[model samples]
Target: MNRPQDHLAEQDNVRRVDDVTSALEGLVTVLGQEEDLSVVLRRACLQAVQAVPDADLASITLVRDGGHYTATSTGDAANRIDQAQYDAGQGPCLEAARTGTVQRVEVSEVARRWPEFTAAAGAAAVVSYLSAPLFIDTEYQGSLNLYGAGGDGFGALDAALLELYTTAAEAALRGARRYVSARETVGRLRTALTSRAVIDQAKGMLMAMHRVSADQAFDLLVKRSQEQNVKLREVAEWFVADVLNA
Candidate 1:
């Protein structure tokens, strides 16, 4: 027969699972609607704090090129704590981002592991830290960091839940990044096509007016572009406009 405490524990586990599911679903929905990565990250930070019971504050550390910075945070305390790590040049968040692993540390261990970070975080009354690596395609590597003020700190279960959440968050970030990249490519192609059409029309006009060959007409446009120090497309557009007006 199951004990009463065991049944209560089962209920708590089920509830936590549901909460995590809901948070992940919400993050997916937000990612689908927002093409701006900044907005998506900010929302993710908020959801992370809400989903993790032990997290008092949340922030995201993004590493781009060769530098790392906090991309988003739930509040000033989170930002300050994150800045402490960046200034110290070593902390749980940086370690997680660098190694692509999780870092869960209690207050007692923080002093020994990251003395510089300990002083800053201690000032803010932060006693626990949890960081999970977040990889978004090849452009960004980051970590989702959670700070806890409670002395009890985070448990194994809490770390497991955060890892699960970050895994889902990474997938959503990858999809969003790909979508944004594709949209930009399409836009550039459209612009190129439009420029090509304008240039072709100008070439046809020059060929007719000057009774010149197609190559000669193109040369005339290039000459004007170089003389005016303007783009070939601009010269073509101006020529077309002048001919139409004539």
Candidate 2:
């Protein structure tokens, strides 16, 4: 009981949704393969650059100490200029991160509001800007900044496009966090194995020194470790050092 025109509209809507979903899936697949954080950030910045016209460049900064952020990856010349904003902490990039607000400013306008950042940025010939925040929680809001050197820095339509890129960037950041955790876990596991091996070697030295069974040597090592309130690895190290000194 539907008109053909109505059916076509519904199909169009479905196609739009499908396209967005497909793009998102592709982002996940590509980002998941990236082992390094730099590679992930680099891809995210480029994605944002493509989503918004007039955005001559894009960059994503990582949180750092001193209430500051660093440009981890930059998409182009304007983005490289944006790095000075982070170095100075007084432009749309800093403003976006701190207030979690998108800011658009002409080079002249920003010069008034952010003298230091604008001054530093102007030296690199950047003249316009638009920035969005990156949020891990999706609600807390952080920063995803875009830059340009012309008046056409951004427009109303650009906002919607930027949103798509920002969402993808957030997912990429989440993926990078998982990658970091996995590598850390693997490193910890290797350290634990190494610690156990050293402890066993120390245990063997104990058996030789005290002329005791292997089990008795291990028990003696454990008892000493507990009594001294030292770590098993530390106890093993001490034993090795003492034997060497003797």
Candidate 3:
């Protein structure tokens, strides 16, 4: 049966679905466009601030080698909260990262649970908080934290949306990490190749000047390197530079 209220409800549902799709698409675009991990995470936090219901601020925390730091934040409010928690060594974000659990802290319970964080966050006008662990694997773990001015700002739907964001953000972070590692390897290889070419050129110069064989030229460079307590590459560079200057 057709009814005005029913049709309106269906339209609202459709709009909500469309909004979710758009947000996801936008996040994917951000991930694809940003190569710098810090920039990507900063943009991700901004997106969370805009997309999450009742979200006033957002931050991302990365835990590595038994230490934790805030990777990015929407603004000073979020940053201050994260810093307070970090200094205190206890807060919702830390809890989420350590336990891989979602923590939703209500305004009333915040002071009781985390006094230092609550005091700092309350001064910044943040009354509520939610934290979700970002887990791409066992080796890498972090947390996405959101702050709200409203006491009951986040609900079930909000948590679900944040979880979805964290998942996508985690994948993006992993890709960025792999890209960075690969680029570093390529750079190292290039540097090595360049060093080897310079060393060969230095050896050729020695061969011509001293009428020495390749092995003897290489041994001369190594001997000088050991005498000076310097790298073979550095010794070779000195020889090449000396020839250029001469």
Candidate 4:
């Protein structure tokens, strides 16, 4: 025996879930097109603010070698609060990142736990806070935080929504980092190959002009490079340039 109200409530819940799924799908598409890690991180924070209904502000905090900093934040308010925690060496965001756990702080009890963070957040009218730890094995560790301005702050549904957002964010960020690294490696390899090709061309030209062996021509290039105190690649390039102009 299902009541009409219960049926309507179930329908609304389904609609909310659908909306969240669609939003995340859109986020995946957007992130796929981005190659910069910093842009990806900032987009993740902004998306968190939009995806979670109760989230008024969002930010990310990263920890490395016992040092921590706010990677990106939605606004000055969020950064100010995060910096207070980093300065005082205590806050929900820091604790969540260090312990790899979720931290929830209510305005009423925040003062008792982290007095310094509370003072800063209170001035900005932040009434509630939630931090979800993002961990990818032992390599990457950080926390995604959401701030609420007033009312009851965040309920179970809000926390659950934030968890889902963080899950997607972590995946997108890791993929972006890998893509950037691979692109940089490819760029370096290409430059090395180009340099080698130019140097070989210069060596062949020297051997043909001087009627010398490959070893003797290479030794001559090295001698010129040493005499000019320049890179072997530069000496080779100069010789090739001169040949081209001649």
Q: What stretches of model 2 exceed 4 Å from their correct place?
A: 1-26, 67-69, 136-142, 212-246
Off by more than 4 A, model 4 = 3-12, 64-66, 120-122, 135-140
Q: Against the hidden reference, what TM-scores do the models get? A: 0.97, 0.67, 0.83, 0.87
RMSD, every candidate, angstroms: 1.2, 6.7, 3.0, 2.5
Q: Global lDDT for candidate 3?
A: 0.81
CA lDDT, candidate 3, residue 95:
89
Question: What stretches of model 1 exceed 4 Å from their correct place?
Answer: 120-122
**Best candidate per lDDT, number?**
1
- lDDT of model 1 at residue 210? 96
Clashes (backbone N, CA, C under 3 Å), per candidate, total 0, 4, 0, 0
lDDT of 2 by residue, 1-246 (tens): 999999997896565445545556555676768777666666666656655656776777556545544444454565556567766767887777778767776777887898887667656656677877777653224577777757655665456556666776686677677778799999999999989988888988988889999899888888989999998798998898899899
Ranking by lDDT: 1, 4, 3, 2
| Local distance difference test scores for all models | 0.90, 0.70, 0.81, 0.82
**Residue-by-residue lDDT tens digits, candidate 4, 1-246:** 999999998896676666567767766877789776667778778877777767888888887778888888999988888887888888888888878777887877778998877765557778888999976435557788888997788877777777877887677667777777789999999999988998899999999999999999899999999999999999999999999999
Better of 2 and 4 by TM-score: 4
User: For model 1, what is the C-alpha lDDT against the true structure?
Assistant: 0.90
Q: Report the alpha-carbon TM-score of model 4 versus the true structure.
A: 0.87
